[model samples]
Target: MVHDQYMSLSLVNINITSYCMQFIDSLCYILVILGLVGNILGLLIFSSSRHTSKISSVYVYLATSSSIINIFCVIRYALVLHSKTRIIINNLIGHVWFACKLYELSFCFRLISSWIILFWMFERVTCVSKRLRTLFYRWNASQLKFIIPCIIIFIILGCVIGPPAYMYQPRISKNKLSNSTIKSMNYFCGLPSTVSIKWQKYFNELHLGLNHYTIRCFFSELFPAGTIIIFNSYIMYYLFRTSYQFSQINENKITKERQRTTSWMNIVLILHSCLFLSSLFSHVVGHFLSVEAHETWWVLLTVLGNCSLNFYVYCLSGKAFRKQIIHIIQRLIILISYKLQTCKQQQQNHQYDNFKIENLIYQSNHVENINQPKSYGTKNYPKTIGINSSSPISEQETSV
Candidate 1:
């Protein structure tokens, strides 16, 4: 009875795991598609000549950040999908080294994406604080030049830290058959674990404790979150203080407009940072806490949802972003309507031409019939139309 109950519980666990995995797979697929499109649109909006003209040139940082998020989303989803399938696992286990490297690459992308956001927030802060601008004016002017080098530097940093952060280990467990000394080994790609027992102590101390708990939790997440919050608070204070002074004096249209734009930009940045922080916390909870498989899956879905929802957040938060989206939609609608009208016109023209050709062919055939000679039993007669009379045919009558 106990054995049967144990078997049933094991089966239940298996079913739950399968369901959770399927749910994760579906969500990841959705997130991957959304993240690709959203981030691409973000890049276009941030990089557009007209959009950038109105806003600070620092927005280029956002475009770069979107690009990084796109890569991170793709890599993260690929890893999730890879883990869910036995076929993929079997294939990947054969090349464990490559799989490990791919995992490391994904970690690097995620890290880089977060750090890029932090850098962008720093630039925003510099733009808001006059004192910082004095110090960072040249820095802001040369930001375009630094974007590439900054990305390269971050990539190198990620690569250096990524390898130690996570270690992939393929496990082979031996199972002994009943009444037999022989044991069969089952090889499978398993969860991330220490590379070997010999290095377990060092791995836990350095990689898990120092690298993950300290660097990842703090610098990648906590420090950035705190800094962004502080920066945005300072910006809000500066904006309100300036606006109060402007009200006390004569209203300047140019300064007011700039303030409004900055306010809208701040809204977007704040909301984006919130989503990022939420995802970061979700990641920590899902991985570090002892939770059910389905719960972990839900947590991950939330993380990916953050990656996919940034464009929507921008649309909701920023007036300029919303306007750009509206403009693009309007342009697309007009283009589609024009193309449809053109197609309709072309079809109508085709039909009219066909009618004209058919009419000409009918007229030509009638004329040929009129010119041809006709035989009537014992007498030859001419075929005529619009006249009902039996008359002998003449050359003039036939010609007429």
Candidate 2:
């Protein structure tokens, strides 16, 4: 009886795990599709002709970085799905050098995406702060063009520290079967081999606790999160202060514009702060708990949220962004409607041409029947033969 109960419990656990895995996989797939769509729409909206001013450059950078991060999320989720399948594809991707490098680069992109938002907030803070306005007064179109290269360089420099801290390699383990021993391999992205050895040695020798994961997490995740929060808070404070100043002054178009911009930035800052905090919490929890099943879902949800939140914020907050999005949607609808109409017209023309051809063929066949000579049996032979000696029989018969 106890054995049966144990078996039943085991089966129930298996079913639950399967259900959870399926749900997580479905969620990840949906999030990946949404992230791609949202980020692409953001890129299109930000890169438009109307948003070419230096003021919009921060948004342009944010959009570009977010798109790249979305791509990385897609890849990461795909790998997770592959890994869950426990197939050869996962082995190839996980153990291969180039694949490992790509994975590392994804981390770099994630960091870059986070820091880019911080930079954007910094720009906002500077724009709002009276003391900092003069420092950035020279910022122009030419200066804005260099932001992309600077971001690239920043990401590269940040990623340079990753290789020594972590490495990807296949781990081998032995399992004892009923009759024999079996060896299996799994890939891990963790501490470098040397670091792992040193970590053990240091703990054994000096009883000290310092390791690679802690270092990587601190630099890549916590530091960026802290910086973003700090800058975002400053931006908010300065924006409020600036708004108060604007209210005290006499009304002018430029001052009104500045107030509007500050308001927009405040809305964006609030949304980003919420997104960043949620993502950071999930990331930190996943790292510490190491609960693969639940942690994966949490991490993916946070990533999807982070990737898509900005687009929604822009649409909700920025009048220009909303207008551009609507314009793009309208144009797309018009383009699709035009193509559909063209196809329908072409189909109708094709049908009409077919009908005309059919009619022509029918007429040609009727004419052929009329022109053909008709022969009758002996009863009608006299009529058939009496038609005409010189004229065609068919024409004579028709005349008769």
Candidate 3:
């Protein structure tokens, strides 16, 4: 009975594993398609526009970075989907250098994407603050070109710690009793094992303990998320305070436009904050769970959410973005309709020319018969008035 129960449990585990893999495969494909389309559209809209405000320029950079990161994520997920299952396990174990390096690259991009959001929040806070408003407003396009690259370089340098954190080594073990050999991996990123003599001696001699997951979670998830929340809260407070101040003053077109833009920014900030917070929560939960937990799904969901939400947020909140999208769509429609009409007109002209040629041919044949030798009982052509008439042909051609 115990053996049977064990077998049943094994079967259940296998079933669950199969189902999870299938789900992840489907989700990856769906995210790849949707994320690519959405991010590309966003890239086009943000990059092509001319913005007088520095804040809008900041948004353009943010959107561009997000689109790029989304593309990277799609590629990363596609690689995982296509690679061997054991390769993925080795990645999780942190023993395969190739997988570790690939993960590190993805991690760097993820950090950049997250920091971009945090920086955007900071920019908003600066814009909304009365004291900093003048300073931020004075930031011109040339300064933006310098500032954005500097920030990007800083983010890339900061995230360079990822590769070493996930370092590992491969090993093999043998079970003497079973006379079987098994492959084992050692993660240098985790706490040193007390039971293994080699690890114990290594740890005792070096006095080092590294927990990559803990460090990564704190820096990548906790710190950035907390910063975003704090800045976003300050932005909300300042926006409300500014609204009250504006209400006290006399309303004007400029004030109204400022208010509208502020409102849109606030809405976008709130939406993005909610999305990032949810993703952070999912990541934190996945970290605390067992290896067998369906954490990949959570990770995939987080990636998909982060990649796709920005476009929707912009569409819903930014009037300028919406107008641009609408304008582009209208132009496309007009262009297509014009081409279709031109084709139709061409077809009509061709048919009218054919009709004219056929009529002329018939008239010429009738005139020829009239000029030919008359057969017995064949009446002479009456000057071919109807068939050979130029007036009717001219009229037909003119009407066509």
Model 3 residue pairs with clashes: none
Regions of candidate 1 where Cα sits further than 4 Å from its true position: 1-37, 49-51, 54-58, 64-68, 71-75, 78-100, 138-208, 211-220, 243-270, 290-299, 348-400
Give lDDT tens digits, candidate 2, residues 185-215. 4454333445566554322221112433344
State residue 153's C-alpha deviation in candidate 3, in Å. 5.4
**lDDT for 225 (candidate 2):** 78
TM-score of 3: 0.60
TM-score winner, 2 or 3: 2
Model 2 weakest lDDT span, ten residues long: 1-10
Every candidate's lDDT: 0.59, 0.59, 0.59
**Which pairs of residues have clashing backbones in candidate 2?**
none
Candidate 3: stretches off by over 4 Å: 1-26, 52-59, 78-100, 133-162, 165-210, 249-267, 292-295, 332-400
Model 2 residue runs over 4 Å out of place are 1-19, 52-62, 78-89, 94-97, 130-133, 137-167, 177-196, 199-210, 246-268, 291-296, 375-400
Q: Pick the candidate with the highest TM-score.
A: 2
Residue 244, candidate 1: Cα error in Å is: 4.7
